[model samples]
Target chain A: MDLSAINPTLLLASLMVAATPLLLAAIGELVVERAGVLNLGVEGMMITGAICGFAIAVNTGSPILGLVAAALGGAVLSLLFAALTQYALANQVASGLALTLFGLGLSALIGQGYQGIKPPSFPKADIPLLSDIPFLGGVLFRHDFVVYLAIALTAVVWWVLKYSRIGLVLRAVGENHDAAHALGYKVVRIRVAAICFGGACAGLGGAYISLIRVPQWTEGMTAGIGWIALALVVFASWKPWRAMLGAYLFGGITVLQLNLQAAGVAIPVEYLAMSPYLITIIVLVIMSADKSRAPAALGRSFHASQ
Target chain B: MKLSKLLATAAVALGMATGAMAEDKTKVGFVFVGPIGDGGWTYEHNKGRLAVEQEFGDKVETVFVESVPEGPDAERVMTQMALEGADLIFTTSFGYMDPTINVAAKFPNVKFEHATGYKRADNVSTYSARFYEGRAIQGHIAGKMTKSNIVGYIGSYPIPEVIRGINSAFSHARKANPDVQFKIVWAYTWFDPAKEAEAAKVLIEQGADIILQHTDSTAPQAAAQEAGNVYTFGQASDMAEYGPKPRISSIIDDWAPYYIARTRAVMDGTWTSTDTWDGIGPGMVGIGEISSEVPADVKAEALALKDAIAKGEYHPFTGPLNKQDGSAWLAAGETADDGTLLGMNFYVEGIEGTIPQ
Candidate 1:
């Protein structure tokens, strides 16, 4: 029942770490969805990335290389979805579902020899002057590279989607693929690229769990975070900044509940455990009311001939 | 007409080939709650399965489905194993209690053993290691070693088995260090590495220098290692890789001998519903080697406590204990009966939080 034992500084820092994976994955899906393409294979790509990053990191003793390998592995896997849904004109929903199943099985195969082996240490980066700044420094400035990278990528995504010409073209392709095709924009090519980006982000997120968060490879260790990231995209209403907010809120509640339990809070444990999902959905649902909506061509396959 | 005659002959040959193999080999099926590579609970159970195979050689065939969820999916898996002519099946995890009972009834010929569960049927046996005995030793070591006097426990669920471990660990820890405070967080999952690691880290943040986990994963060990000077005990398996420092010791579940015995029982046609709960005494629960990280005197005392529990010279749950609400649970010098321990739902005195119902 000692409430003071729970350190607020550590809590905030942990919230960011916990949310990074979801944020990384959600930001990627936001772009894919913004392009009016729904790739449901995020969970699959994430797990494949987890093992890929873990295997490479353990072999090379470099967390950076592991992160790169993870992104590559995830993008490579997403190419399969791109080929099936784009060129083959297969159903995006079914293809995404199949991708998840394939990814889970595939990761298990790759992770066979990597089990129980720890990945190389990913040191925390303390931003020199910023990290020395009292309360904020401890809460915000001290974290691994991936935590900062996730936030930076979110900002980058927001800027790109809101201001860049490429973002406009991607969004136009998403809104009306047929019209975009008529405008001479290669709709399938935009979507394929978006899907690859989404895959790479999801991979980085997965590797975060393997190389930094849990720091070990266990089968299915991504454990539905990819699916949570998918839910986060809708929660964010396809906005990158909102995705970051939603991820932090979700991660904050998750860490907070565990903290509450340790602090001997009287709330029922079941309710506390479910609070993260409940609070995030409620807050995001409230925030995303009138102005936001899904892409017009979302989940639709574009065939230029049609 | 010639093709039809040839197909019939081929079908008969195929059927006979499978039937002959089935008759010669006794199939054993295992339904695990987590992946076999979890490096903890399921890992040990899977080791027991492998031991059964090694013991019987060509006479036994083992099949396992890992990471099976604890509800209807478990029933489906057990039913599939039974329907596929498995002579014996082991449903590991407490959540599979009812499912094991239900599946056993439908396949009376298939002997079933459920771990860490209470329910039993004529064809279903229940077997569990007395992990609390090992927990007592861990508690002694954790209590002796903690400079912060705060011991963090990561529990998988609020089940009786887990509750029993908490009570045992807490009581012994309290005996060694009266200032020791237990902070328990229920992860509510049997195996989620990320969640387990987070739980461990949160506890460490709250000043828990010694981390004890009831969940099955090595993630906590890694978390403790990162947070240097923190101590952790391996659960269900010897997480020896992190030894001599963070993982100062471990509680290992040795189910190999029991699995081999049960498989032999089924083979000998002497199988019946029985409850087997063995502690360090029977070697079902083992105390992993105490690493040099522990002071020599403290290590000796911990080993002594383990021996006393193993040789029946002492009972971890001896009386003079009170419930969390200050109600008398055991009178002075009175030991707990197996019945009460099996359905333990309350925390002993000095524990701060209530068990999540």
Candidate 2:
């Protein structure tokens, strides 16, 4: 195996592309969880966003407008879950799952006429001097705006969680929702906002795939990236910076395995192909083995009356 | 007495008017497993659907639903189409076989043509090309041209259609050069460019100088171009624009003729359920133009094999074959039967990798 065959710069650049979807989804879920609501419909929302983005972009011939439509599409679908869980007082877990099923069906129906047509691509925003810097330019400065947005969101999330008062209130609600409700904090309202935020982020992630990565809308194009993002949230112990780190780590493993196969490494391609998922499972196992980390109300449903 | 007679006459006229306006058009439906814009297999099939409309004009009306997952949903869509006056339906994926059969039992009047499937009923017909024929040509070119003996194969699924191509290509490679070896990668999907590109990259790193894919994407071609010295074959589309440096030839799936022919059969009242498998001779399995990058003698040798196959003088899966475990699979000079080929699971002698369960 020739190690020199693998270009570190190219691998890093590709890793960022692979990580963006997961990062977008994970960051959205983080805010949702911190507000004491658990939504397991990321996959559904992402797919809906994918089709909506593709359709709007093809119709309008504008990629940016397509992304906006995707975010709105995802948020609108997410509202159904919010209404059921908040107003009807339905079970959060069951409602979230239902949202996913509904999203999948609706997206398929809407995507019927949009299939086989290519949408406009997002132009790269080359950071003038930074993009020209020998290796760093290729690795960091030469990506679409969405990639930079994902990284910027990570830092913003990290700051909000560590320093902001709204973040504290959200954390308080997640930890003790009944107490927060008694303190005049509208528990349902806060959770609803967080859910919408999560939905929009997942939509952006879906749009990233449709607009940048594959540059065409295909069925199930997210390919369980939402699940990976959910796992990243846990693997990072629900911390923003850790989530970013986890995403890149997972992305790196994926990139390396492919590079290894391309470089003619004497390994079975199946094993290499399965490595990314296997590594994610292993990381989850290690993180949960000690049982020392994880949010207190990670999967627990909060009841206002209780 | 005059008012009652006038009301009765008006009601009868209104009923006749509604009946006249309800004339049905010839409704045709398509069920696709992947999104139509996959730029490969599904895309080619969809193009055929468009061609049918262009040929028939006002005589036929068409509609399709893409990304319909295989299994229960397929049955639902097929049933819905049948109920909605779909006189003809095309299920465009192998996994839709059982669903097509089940739905065919219910809608005996609706004609169903399933792509790359074997099972058939009174209303259902199976149609696929001998794609392995194109793969044989690719293997001959790769075998003669490769600086490295390793050839990469990006397989979509382990189903018989894909496996046959792998075996046929390997057989040709072995015949052309005894030292040629195949490295296989299964992406387990028909169209995921990210994964397909990754699979290609892996193979190239492992010393594969030539790459062939059974998956639906131009990703392998893109990856080969990026790698610079590698060569590849386009699957299901003529991706020559990305070729010469990397993509030399392609296996184009030309469904327009088959589609047009089937619709014509329906119009002429001669449609029957039969399995149709045509290759290069009939232009069903389109072999793209061999690029100028290929050596003159190498191109000649590849064309010789292509001509023989086209003329029915050469069979890619001829006898004296053995399974990967060294067990004889076919008797000397005995070609594989359609039944065996349809259910192929074993690898040929030259393949070093095992098919995953």
Candidate 3:
């Protein structure tokens, strides 16, 4: 492969753009999982956000407001799953699946009239002097505000998880809900809050696509980005900074394959197109092989009676 | 008892008459594989549906269900439309071909129109466009205008409709300049702006100065404008506003004529089941106003080719073509037939990549 054909600056910029959605979603999922909840319906929440964001943005003519609406939309949808899994004690897996189905159908119905219309563009925030630094400036400093916000969120999440008392309680809940409940941590409430956070992040990611990435509403607009975010959470071993790294790595692969095809590299376009997903799977398998790194309570359901 | 018997007879006769009259309204329904707002394929088809409605007023009543994924769900949707008294149905997209055929079997009385597909039944007719014709024009313009020999193409799927477009564009590009190389990226999606923009940026970074897309959405145009110096053609709509900088021309899908004509045929009771593939010649494929950004001579060349193609004097897929392996695919003075083109699975000689399995 001819690596010289790859433009590092453009690749970095595109990687940021592509990774924003995943980073937003993975960080959300990481929080949810850390609070002893597993929501597989991140895809559904993201798509709902995509449609809601597009609809609001088109009507209001403000992309920022649209993203906020998207986050709220996603959180609202996640509340349904929270109610079922947390209150009714329904199967987490089934409720998550239902959430996805419901989100997809609801988004389609609401998005029907909003098709073929373009939403307002997001403003790019250029970092003063850094934006003028030849190659690095264009790649890192010349992105929309959401890109920087997502990175900043990763730092904040990492800091909170590492130092804060509430973070310790959330981690304690994940480690053993029964013990946390006995210690007066309000296990159900904490989990519900985490679920809402995950939904909002997924919504923001979805909104980014509809508001900034594609800036239009189309059916299935999320297009498996949610699933990729879920996988990123696993690849990151449920850590926030690692989630950021995994998202960019996946984004880089995606951008790189397209670049290779454009540079006339002698690889089948289909293989290159599928490389991102395949690489994600490989990374996940490798991560899983190091069994000690995985969260002990991952995918396990906790009950008050137990 | 005598009064009750007479009332029952009158009601039976009235029901029969109402059933017959309901069948005469020419209810045309549409089954879309994707949402109509995709601003590309389904959007254009929905526009055609609106045109049919406008042209045939009371003679036809149209209804549509969007985002019907192509599979059993398609079968269910078609069946429902048929049950709801759709006299004529248009199933758009190739993936609907089999389901259309399946539904056609169950509703032998209903007339079915399948778009961009070849499957036909006693009640089913197929319709498509020679979109490759328009792509030829785009190729001519791109070839003439590009400062860099590299051109980017965002393709939706490996289906024949998209493949034919790639081949047509490449043929014209090669004709304009032997050194012109195409960078084709398969997004494997019909309409996702994020993916499409990503594809365009990749091409731009690799030195492509012009872009073409078989995918839906205005992302490629937006990307071209953002990159500067990169030119693009509108895929399904006149996306000129999105590209004040790089949009040179657009292939507008004018489905009004076909929609109106088909409805008229149904109204006249002369709607026979047959495949119709119309292009710029018959006004089905519309070439939007060429932007002033293109060089005067390049615009002239593009128009000349368009006129020739419209007049049937030029064939985009004509002669001297070879498969990707350098084997003789078509001899000089030979043209590809509908059957071969419909099943086009291999790349042309100049295309360096293999089709993904």
Best candidate, lDDT-wise?
1
Give a tens-digit lDDT track for model 1, residues B1-357. 999999999999999988788897989999999988888999999999999999999999999999899999999999999988899999999999999999888887889999989888888899998998998898889889999999999999999999999999999999999999999999989898899999999999999999999998899998998889899998999999888778999999999999999999988888888999999999999999999989999999998898899899999999999999999989999999999999999999999889888
The alpha-carbon root-mean-square deviation between model 3 and the true structure, to one decimal in Å, is: 6.2
Clash totals for all candidate models? 0, 10, 0
Q: Please give the ranking of all candidate structures by TM-score, highest first, separated by commas.
A: 1, 3, 2
Using lDDT as the yardstick, the better of models 2 and 3 is: 3
lDDT of 3 at A67: 90
Please identify model 1 stretches exceeding 4 Å from their true place: B1-20
Against the correct fold, how does model 2 do in TM-score?
Answer: 0.74
Model 1 docking tier (incorrect/acceptable/medium/high)? medium
Estimate TM-scores for all models: 0.95, 0.74, 0.83
Which candidate, 1 or 3, has the higher TM-score? Answer: 1
lDDT, residue A90, candidate 2: 83
Q: Order of candidates by DockQ, top first?
A: 1, 3, 2
User: Which pairs of residues collide in candidate 3?
Assistant: none
Measured over all alpha carbons after superposition, the RMSD of each candidate to the real structure, in angstroms, is: 3.0, 7.2, 6.2
Q: Which candidate is the best by TM-score?
A: 1
| Residue-level lDDT tens digits of model 2 in A122-177 | 78899999999998999999998989999999999888877998888888877777
Model 3 alpha-carbon miss at residue B261, Å: 4.8
Runs in model 2 deviating more than 4 A are A1-17, A36-159, A172-220, A227-306, B1-23, B319-322, B327-334
- Candidate 1 lDDT over residue span A171-214, tens digit each: 99999999999999999999999999999999999999999998
| Each prediction's whole-model lDDT (CA) | 0.93, 0.82, 0.84
